[model samples]
Target: MAFAANTALISSPTLFTPSKFSSSRLYLSVPYKTTKFQLYCKPSSSLPLTSLFCLRKKEKSVLSALSDDFPAVLDEIEGNSGWDVAVEGEEGEGGFVVQPPEEAKVYVGNLPFDVDNGRLGQLFGQAGVVELAEVIYDRITGRSRGFGFVTMATVEEAEKAVELFSRYDMDGRFLTVNIAAPRGSQPERAPREPGHRIYVGNLAWSVDTGRLEELFSEHGAIVSVRVVSDRETGRSRGFGFVEMSTESEMNDAISSLDGEILDGRPIKVNAALERQTRGRF
Candidate 1:
């Protein structure tokens, strides 16, 4: 029997899908006013029947995002016994966003370059129970970034760890342990103000922050000074950075102190370059 179009008006306005019908071929009748999709099945004398699907009001002349082999998929779907649901994400979830956990995690900095996740968990376990510990690694080089985060079992435990480990020496380097900031809570760091900083090289291993400050304080109002140290030995790395109060002070220091001797070594001074980074995506 041939069923005319618009002959069947589903009272609930429920969708008419081939999965709802058991027959190999269907002369389904649907109205444009009701369904978002229209389905028409073509019966073939071959093993599998062909089906055509179309959206009712969509003006697109094509399926814009279909893969090259999507047509092969339609050919493969024969008389399916059930409806197939599609999900967006790779894990089969519908692109769900996960919320950050409670404030029981601590950021651990000044870590040794060789520290591993297991070591971090063990170290943080000294204060209280540790749920997880992971060392961040460089994406390309796969080296530890000398910093990691640790999740405590309770907020009180996290607080205890912060109190006990902040500035606590680990492998000759003092640690900077504190509550981890929630991701995305901070704005992107602004660029450094122009001409307020200078890079000093050819530093002596004996030179510390205090010594460097004493040396440069004569040139300008010193904002801060730091002597970079090796993560392993906690000794000066023969270079440092200094920030002055103003552009004029920075220029005066760079011009007058470039070849000045400090700690028996002639230091090289120049405007500090912005640090290069592999951007996080």
Candidate 2:
């Protein structure tokens, strides 16, 4: 019976069977008609060979299609089965084998702030075909977060990128490249606080409440803008607060303004935390 190349080898007896035996291990030949590849196995001591190595009937194959040639089988599966990494840690130690995250996604860090997705893709394409590239941006400022992700066409290609591009210099800055963590492994961020107020910091000395309002107004409706000034000097204290007309407007302002460059300096913006007041004893 012809099996899809992407199909799991365990699916059919003709593809993988106990063909050769050594003292301790068994060599299973994965044959697609005329082409043969050996898959090494240590047979289970307690189960029958068929029971231990066979695949279920209903499950779909992992490869793309059954082919008459070996290289085509690699091509078929390379495009179809995404990385399904399985990682297990040892007791008291982190000894494990992890497949590249989600098949071919790679993390790129220490990037220049000006590098966009297109530039990043072109840079990574040197290792292999890049399927997609994206740079994370602050929601308000639309400025890059100095990191991004790239998905390669295949797992081998992703590995090649890590091998060649990790520590690669781009305009004097070295980049950090690695297999991206699976989505489930990422930490959950705390929800933004309620209230239409946001904190803005790292203001240019020349920036006044008016300029602040004008800059943020492009993002949303602003209720008020307050630049905190020094109590003694009357000069700008270099920080301020902005109140948007609504929570949505506040969020928009945060997303657009944080990481925004002003006077060659990136500003910090975030949801306003409630100010703590001293309690009378």
Candidate 3:
């Protein structure tokens, strides 16, 4: 994700706090011009008196206006700055926006080839409500992609799910969890039909298209093998796709090669599903 440019202006303390006091409070004897200054008082006197002074007009200087009430006042600052602090929950409490539970949508990545929907749900269901769990499979091959998605009822539950199952070990493999993006937005593609292409990752750095084809050909006939290469470096990306002559071959290749040791490296295979053509399709 790319972040927008941020420019912050730091003001000297004197610029923000009230510089002029009531003339009545200004006395010749007073070292400072003002005396009997009516400093802003916090509802709770237990707070330090220093917090009553408001210093610096710029948004960054609001830190000088430190008080229990500071959060409330900062909330009133209208504009982009409000959103920056608000999203961070700077108030030290749950902010106005409620975060969905952790289990809302579970991202199950780095999976072993054999994991399926039932196993994925059973694993996460241990933590909280699992509305649904599915191991993405190649449509043509019907093989596990080593990753899946799970959905919980709420954001809080979703968060809990991630915390509880992010590193969950099942069948001797550890899983990774992130708040799942909406359906169809995952990196793994669905299985394409005969002559359909899909991505393969975690390949041995030394493996090439011909080597991959030769290795997977035992399961089925490979029509084409394309190893994605870096544009700048012009080197194999350690991943690529194999287009099979038939859907059965695709599935056979996925089941046989996925998670199987190839040249001493474990490979992950899944169907390259169609890319979502439209939003929410």
Among the numbered candidates, top lDDT falls to 1
Taken over the whole model, the C-alpha lDDT of each candidate is: 0.67, 0.66, 0.59
Candidate 2 per-residue C-alpha lDDT over 140-238 given as tens digits, one digit per residue, 9 for 90 to 100: 546676689999988999999999998787753467788887777875544545558899999888887668877887877665566777757667888
Quick one: ranking by lDDT, best first?
1, 2, 3
Query: Could you tell me the lDDT of residue 164 within candidate 3?
Result: 86
Best by TM-score: 1
In candidate 2, stretches whose alpha carbon ends up further than 4 angstroms from where it belongs are 1-101, 186-281
lDDT of 3 at 14: 36
Superposition-based RMSD of candidate 2 using all C-alpha atoms, in angstroms? 17.3
- The count of residue-pair clashes in candidate 2 stands at 19
User: In model 1, which residue pairs have backbone atoms overlapping below 3 Å?
Assistant: none
Query: Tens-digit lDDT track for model 3 on 1-281?
Result: 11223412122223232466443221121121111112222233243323232232223322232335444544443231222222222243344434444437777875766678888888787777777888897554465655788887677777888888775655444566888766556566546434455567888878866687677767765555656767676567888887665778788888777787877888889897666466672
**Cα shift from native, residue 156, model 1 (Å):** 0.8
Q: Model 1, range 87-117, lDDT digits (tens) per residue?
A: 2222322333232256898999867677899
TM-score of each: 0.37, 0.34, 0.33
Q: Model 1, residue 255: what's the lDDT?
A: 95
Instruction: Give, for candidate 2, the lowest lDDT window spanning 10 residues.
Output: 35-44
Q: Higher-TM-score candidate among 1 and 2? A: 1
